[model samples]
Every structure is written in C-alpha cells, then in structure tokens.
Target: MPHSLSWGARSIFKNRYEFKVRICYLVGEGRDLNFWTDPWHPDGPVDSQTSIGTMLSNIPRNVSVHDIRSDSDWKEVLNSGPYGELTQIVHSGLFTKELPSYPLVPWYSSLWFPGHLPRHCPVVWQAIQSRLSTKDRLFFLGSQRDSTCSLCRSEPETHHHLFLACSYSSWVWRFILLRFGYRRKPNNGLQKEEEWLRKTFKGKGQIARAIRIAFSATVSHLWKERNRRVFEEKSTHKQQTLKDILDIIKFKTLYLKLQDIPSEKNIRISNILGLPCFSKEKSSRHCTWDPPPEDMAKLNSDASLANDQGSIGGLIRGSTSNIMVMFSWNKAPETISELELEAILEGVKLARSMDIRKLWIETDSMNALQIITGKCNCPWRKKVTLKLLQDLLTSFEMWKVSHQWREANQPADYLSKHDCPLKGIKILPTTA
Candidate 1:
C-alpha cells in the first residue's frame, strides 16, 4: 500500500500515529505481547501504561503474558495484589474480547415529499407555530403600537384572534367553509381549526391536493391582507379578498392536474365558488411521474427542514402508479442533507417491509443522490450519511436510487412539508 501511493498520500498516512484506543481486546494465547503497552485490559491502562522507573520495581518493561505464570501457587505470585485480576480472569478462561465498534445511530427516519406540498408551506408552518409577527407579539417586544386586530380592530391581535376570532376574518372563514361544504360552524379557537385542516387535507391523493392548497392559500392570503392593512394603509373588501384567495387556490390546484377527486366534491366547490372547472396543466415531457416496470415498485422520497427542525416523507407506487405506501416523520435534525439521506433510507425500509424485491428509488436531492450513487466523492463530514447509504444499497438485490425532478415528485414533496398526524412509520389511509 505504501509503495503504490503518491507522495502526498504516503505522507498523509506516514504520520497517522493516532489509532483508536477506545477498544477492549480479548485475550488469546498471549505468546507475543507487551503487557504494559498493549490495550488488552478490560479497564484502561493506569498511568498511561508506561514502563515503571528503576526506583519503582524490577518488573521488566517487556514482561510477556506467560512470564507471570512462573509461580503457579495461588497464594504467592498469583495472589499478589497487582496481578490478582488477571489471575482470576485466566482461571476462569475469560480472556480478551474486543468490544464492537459503534454503528450508525438509528434515530433518523426519512420523510419523502414534493416541492409544493402545500403552496408556500414554510409560511403556513410558521402560522401554525405562532411564529408570525402579529401585533401583540410586536407590542410584547416593546413596539410603541396598538396591539389591535388589523381586520376587526376589536381585540388585541394575536395568532389565534387574527386567524380565528376576529369578526371580519370569521366571515371569510365561514364563506370558505361553506364553499368547502363544511356544515357545522368552526370550533371556537385556532387549535381546533388546525385539527380540521389536518383531517381534511392530509393524504397522498387528488382530494388531498385540493384541500391542502386551499388551506395553505387561506393562511397566506390572510397574512398578506393583514400586512397590507397595517403596513400599506390599504385593505381589500372581504369579497375581493375571497376572490384573491380562490384564484390562488385555483391556480395551485390546476397545476397539480388532479385526477382522482370525487365528482361531487368538484361540483360542490366549483358551484359554490362560481368558478370554471379546474384547469389541467400538461405534464412535462421530460419530467413527470413514471412507474417502475412490471413486477417492481418505485419509491420516491423527499425531506424538508423548517425552523431548525427536519422532516422526511416518501411515496411507494406500483408499476401502474397505484400507491402502495406513503410515509412521513418529524425529525429533530437541523440540516437538509441529513434529512434528505434519512428520507431515502426510510423509503428503502418501507419497500423492504412490503416484501417488494425489485425497486427504483427516486429523490429530488442532487447532493444526496450523488453521495448514494458514488457519482462524486463523499465529504469527510458526511461519513455518517455515507455509511447509511452503504447499508441501504446492500439491502436489495435489484434496486436503484436516482435524482428525479421535484416536478415529478409531488406526493412525496407534500408529505415532507406537511406534518403527518401519525407517528413513526405509517401506511396510508390508516383507520382512526
């Protein structure tokens, strides 16, 4: 190995004096060994295992393991305090066994999702977390401003009151709910409204696409309208605002080219909103969802990081484009690369669990795909991710993970961005 290496490579390894000292070695036939220097003890060496000075004692620096056996009597050389632990071990025939190396931590779960999960997902997620800059929050931060609802001006502005309790916003919400065919009035607060959003919108299907876009649009436009009223000193009428929200939701829903929405839902929303039939965008010739070959399944995975937290989501489809599984998880990692790698690994695990032997995996992360496919050199900092990719590769007889366009991976993208109500690994359409 030294002879074949270039000068720089050779120089790098030449000074590699630091080796792992964290291992405990098993005792074998200790024929050729140095007791003092070797890390063969279960407990680590004392005093750095250096040779004792001449003033200390006459025990030779190169004492062999067998040399200690000269005095076989239990009370003499063996029972001497220093060597007693080793004697007990030898008597019991429990010599050295090196502890196993640390494997990759298993805390990560992959979430695969599409780029447009919910339109402007980050903004809506912030709304859910009460991270938006409502007036009450600004006042708390020492702003010399009235902490009043921008729309209603009847109560102090807050995440909950602005989105839920204000009379003007309530009218808008009631109108949209009526259009959504929601018969019962909304519950009294924001959390309940959020629960409704989750129940109505989350799934890997066409109906899910419609509701998710509407939900995201409502959050976004409401925030935008509030900002306009406060910052621009202008406000649109409630009817005009509704039209804007509808147009935005319609634009998003149109691009998805949803094929599976029930006709009754289509009629109800369209009739109520007084809009044309949902427009359909042509799928790109080069970038569109494609199924794997017969007798195989394709797994598409994606991940997103929001507010210093990470999540993963994925979709598995048969050759006919029938979804067999979809999954998502909220993760604590703060980086996109780790989340992306985790999503792919979890997709692989999902397929294996389904007994799907042949597979084609798709991800929208170029960096992650490159690392997994060996198209580029792995960075030293990504060693943990690289190990995980290696483990994933070895698990399937016929499998491939490739980078696909975000345009083609909508379901996975949606899942990565949307917080799933379920925990851990989940299959889709789960019963309550």
Candidate 2:
C-alpha cells in the first residue's frame, strides 16, 4: 500500500529470506505504524481499526511467520518474486489468488512448479490417462466389474496392473529388460519405475533415448495388444512382444547410426552391406554351397523399391531349370544405386552359398553389371560393387557378368516382389 514500495526497495530485498521479512513488516505496519505485541491482542496486531487488523490478530504468530505474511500479502509479494523461482512461495499459498478454483492443497506437494515434464511427457501422460479412462468406462458400460483387467480379464485393471503389475505386464517388462541386458524386476508404481529407468540408463550412450522409445513403444504396443485381446478375443504372446522390442531397437540403432555418417560413400556402403563402416575391421562369414556344372550355372538377380521397404532377391540355376542357390535380403536404402548394390551383393552371396565353381551372373541393373565385370567404373558405385566382386571371386572357380533386361529377370523379380519360394536347389541354405 506504501506506493507498492519502490523497485529499489524490492530489489534490495531480493534475497528470498530478506524479501519474506520485508513482506511481513509491510503487512503488519503499512507505512505509518508498527506491530503491537500486547495482551489484548495475543497475536501481533496490524493497524487498529481495519478488517486486516482483526485477521492479523487471529493468526497465531507462533505459526510460520512466512505463512502468515504470505496469507496477508498474497498477490503483491508473489508478483515481486521471480517468475519461475517462486515455487516455495507459491506452495506456501502466496500465489493462490492467481489460481482460483484450484484445490486448496497442492496435488503433488513435492513436485516443483513451472513443472517441466520430460519433453513430450505431458502428451504421453494424457494419452495414457485417456486410454485408462476409456477402459474404465467401457467396463462400466458392460455392467462388468470396473476393476477387471481388460486384456487378461483375470485381475483389476488399474494403470499399474495394465502397465506393470499384472501377469501380462510382467511378461512385457521381462521382454524389455532381457533385450536391454537389464535384470531388474518391474514395479507397479510410476515414480519407482521412472527412477529405475533413470538410474539404470545413466551415462549410457543413446541408451536413455532407446529406453524412452522402448517404453513408449511398449505402452503403445501393449495398449494395442490389450485392445486386440478385448475386442477380438485374440491372444498375444510374449515372444511376439520381444520381437517387437528388438525390431524397434534395431531400426532405431540403424537410423541413428546412419545419421552420423557424413560421406555418401559410407552411407551407401552401410545400406548395401548392412554393416557399419567402422565395423569393417570385424570378420564376416559367407555361405558356401556346391556349384552346378560349368555350362549350367546361371545366376539371376533383381532389385525392387517400395515406399515402405526394399529388397533384393537372387538365385543361381542350372540349364535344366533346377535352382542351385537363392538369396533374398531386405534393405533400407534411399537411392537407386544403393538398391542396385544390394542386389549385386545378393548375387555374390548366392554365388558363395552355391560354391559355384563356374558362374554366369546376370542382373537387370546394366550399370551394376558393367561395374562388376570391369567394363565401367562409376566412382560412386565402384567402392561397394568392387567389394562384392572381390568377395564373389574368393568362392567361384570362374565367373562372368551379363546384363539382362529387367523383364528377363522374372524369377528373381517375382521373388523380390512376392518372396516366391525357389525349388530344386540341392545345397543346404545358410543364414546371412
């Protein structure tokens, strides 16, 4: 009230403890007076004739002085405090005037204000709550017990049960922990779970991001699996859930690792070879199979790109139309040359698998075929295609390259597009 106190006076009391004391002094004495500590007023008294005086007399001075001052100068004192630095003051009720209709007691008393949740956590939180609320309503609408697990139909379906505590959730968490090499048991409480994740992944590279992605993916997958079980009476398996986690981890690892490679050559090599450039020092094993007769071994390869996924499928065949060896691999590549290199690698891998003593390799990619046979050298394509040819040379006694029209490569094309199974290969198959 004393002209709202000058900015200088307020600035001088910037130390929180000092500002609190000044607020108490101002509330008790306005500008012209001082507090009276006498028997008529067991507590301290403000000015003699006002409602504020009566209110001040009722509040026990033995109580926290800060609390008393906060109640009296709620708006002015809080406004003077730093915006996000007033958590203690706000929690002490100094800013309740700004939050009308909010509960008198703080919902989460230990939580700090300006409440910065993890990035995107509020969206996740609301999505989780909305899903739980929907499940609750659905249960009640069916005249069923609102407490039953929607997925298992065997236990209460609170957020903890659905996500962490129930038998179904236990399996889901076990799958996640095993994939991450963690051995901790999953807990039901949200805070406990969050703490476990934070402590376990602290200082691990990209692991915290992986954990968050896995957690969110688990939430989404489990919700979908639960809905499937409830609506379609479908059963979800632990193995399938584990597969989902691994698949997500693999995809995220590849995506983030590729982002770090600056050179187009290294990226193309990674996409075509499915191996990181840094991993070139590591040993790789190739499959070897019995070669067909010298005049009969004919290798066919095809590459196809779709918006969602790309693949190269190839096979070696004999003059009698007997398939000698076949290979198919899915690759995540952005460019046509990457796809072509992937196809050539598939051919080389197939040639190795068949142990083709004499080989006539055919491809729909004429440029790739030209590079492989050394008729041309595309500086861009040479590094990867040369690597493939080098690997192929190690297994075959003789090899020739021929360019075929895309339409002529029907078997590999059909297999690339539809995964048509090959027949008549006597050699044992091997995993890549």
Candidate 3:
C-alpha cells in the first residue's frame, strides 16, 4: 500500500485476487489465526461481513480464533456467534474450491519475448495493463488540471486515445508499420493493437524480434515525450520521436546475429538498419569460385528446400576444375542446415571413395559450414551427422572447409534445384 513501492512489488500487489484464491486456512486449534482478519472460514475473511460497531463491541480486533473456542467444539462456538451460519460451512469442508481464481493473461508472451529491451519493458507492460498514469487516470484521481493529450492537445489522454486515436501517436505507429512492411493500418484501440501485434509477430525469428523492439521503443518514447510535455514543458517533433525509436531499434538489433542465410524480409530489414546478415567478416559480393591446388580435389555442395521438402546436390571437381562426380538425392523434409550438412557429407564420401588424398569443401550455408568446422554449436538433432562427417574427413591427408556465395556455387546450385530425382527413380550416378 506504500506509494514508494517498486513496479515489481506493485504488480504482485495488483494480482492479489489471483494469489488470494490459492490460500485457505485450516484452523488447527486456531492458535495462530486472527479471529477477524484471517480467512479461516470456507467463505472468506469474517470481518468482510461484520459491521464496524459489531466488531468494536463483540471482540477485540487482535483476538485469536483459539481464544473464542476455548477448548469447546466449533459448533458450540459458532452457535453463540451472530446468526450461526458458520456451523454448516465448517461441517462441510474448508476447501479452496469455492474461491475464484484468475485466468492467465494471453499477452504475457508478447510482452516478454526473447531479446526484449529491459528498460523499455516496464513502460510497455504498464501500457498493456492500463496502469500508466495517463492524464485521464490522473483526472479521475483528482490530480490533473487537464485530461487532454499533451502531444496532440485534442483527445483525452487515455491509453486508447494516446496510443492509437491521437493524431501524433497514430502517425508514429503508421510510420513504424510501413517500416516493418505491414500494409494494414493500426487497430482502433490500444487493446486491439496489442492483440494484433501478438497474433502477427508470434515467433523467435529476426523479423519478430524487430517488430517487438519497435513496439516497446515506441511506447517508452511516447510516454517519455508525454512526461516531458507535462513536467518539463518541452516537446519533440513526432518525426524526431520516430527517428529515436528507429535508432534504439538499430542499436538493440546489433546484438542479434542473423541466420546463416537470412530470409528476404530479414535481409531487407538488415539492410535498412545496416546489420550484417552474414556471420562472416567478408562480404559475399566479392566471393568467387577458385580452383584448388593441383594436388587437391574440391567438392562444392548445395541444398534446396521448398515447403519442407528438399534435395541435396554436389559435384566433386579435380584441381583442374574437371568434374569427377555429380550427385543429387531427394530427401524428406528437414531443416535446411541439416540438408546442407548432408550434402557436404555425401560430397566428402564421394571424394573419399575416389581415393582423393587432399580435398577442399565449399558450401553456400554458413551455418552448416560453421557446424562442420566447429565454429558454432551444432543442433542436437544434427550432432550425429556432424560427428560422422568429422570422422570421415580424417581419412583425407589434408582437408579444408570454406563458405562460398551461391553465385559462385552455380553447378551445385543448379543440380540441387533441377536434378532431384523422384522417390522411386533408380537413377545412376554421373561421373566424368
């Protein structure tokens, strides 16, 4: 009840109804129970129904439950009290089944997804819970001179009006929506907008993270701007506020490394924010095919996946770039990285079978390459494959693995895309 309580403590206090339902007192001699304040009854706290005059005269406020019983049965003790309604209730049972429990809120995951901004979380959480001290709430509590939004100076400063209905906030939201490539306009109210965001950005991918960052940043900045206008008598242009939001997003996303081969949307956003989509230090633009040393044979492999079905393809070429073997195999749906690792495994197996002493491997997937080279963690499901592949590479006198741009791995890319045979096709392997 103290005004100086922290937000975390305040949140716990606010959910007292949910917490209160799970607690029920079983009176064992009632030595420790307060007669009035304690919820020893099956119903609830006894003091809730008692009048102030009745409480003052009947018993001391600090009286314990055991003091009234005094070694007597509960029925006799209850029969002497007012109206004796506690007799049947005590006889039946003291179960929490009668207490009303609160259901879990659905928006919790959206509010606290992975990689969320810590400082921005509280503001967004307050907004979602309608706990922010907006001007309307202040006015209702008799502490505000005006309830109009400071940014727009037109609409009442309620959560719905400030977040969605206000002209300034709406423009900021629309601009962010466009930046995220959302064609639909924001919803009519704060709750609807929150529900829309939860339903739309429901994943742990880059785009989802970006969307959440934008939402949290916008809410925090908007509240900040509102406070500035009210307390500091200063204002920032809505465009500048939006730019600040983008800057926060850009800063936060720097820690989020992209997937080995990012999606088109992730690439677009990364480019917009100037994030490095590839894990490699070098850019893929300058990557080109290079023939290995005269003593080494190079294996280039690639995988293509569509609708969870995929194929792996590769070609082992001699030091002179002469193809020694070309292979493509259709496969059941699996992760793209697994398929890429499979392609490398098949290519290496082919080279080993041909008695190549020194070998070089190239693939377009940085993830698979990293896993094979021990540069990153291998997914648990693909550990066996990677372990076998690593063991097989030990057969070669000398071997190296490297990432190549899809542009340079054209032969393997073409075979992966077009040369995949059907499930029952008994196709023969091609060799030079």
Query: What's the TM-score of each model vs. the native?
Result: 0.39, 0.32, 0.47
The whole-model C-alpha lDDT of candidate 3 against the native structure comes to 0.78
Residues 95-160, candidate 2: write the lDDT tens digits.
211212455422121121222224434434544444555456656688555557866678767666
Q: Given candidate 1, what's the lDDT at residue 22?
A: 60
CA lDDT of every candidate: 0.70, 0.56, 0.78
What TM-score does prediction 3 earn?
0.47
| Candidate 1 TM-score, true structure as reference | 0.39
**Span of 10 residues, lowest total lDDT, candidate 2:** 107-116
**By TM-score, how accurate is candidate 2?**
0.32
Worst 10 residues of 3 by lDDT: 87-96
Report how far residue 62 has shifted in candidate 2, in Å.
57
Highest TM-score: give the candidate number: 3
lDDT of 1 by residue, 335-431 (tens): 6876888888788877887888888988888988887877877677667767866776687778877779988888999989876654656776543
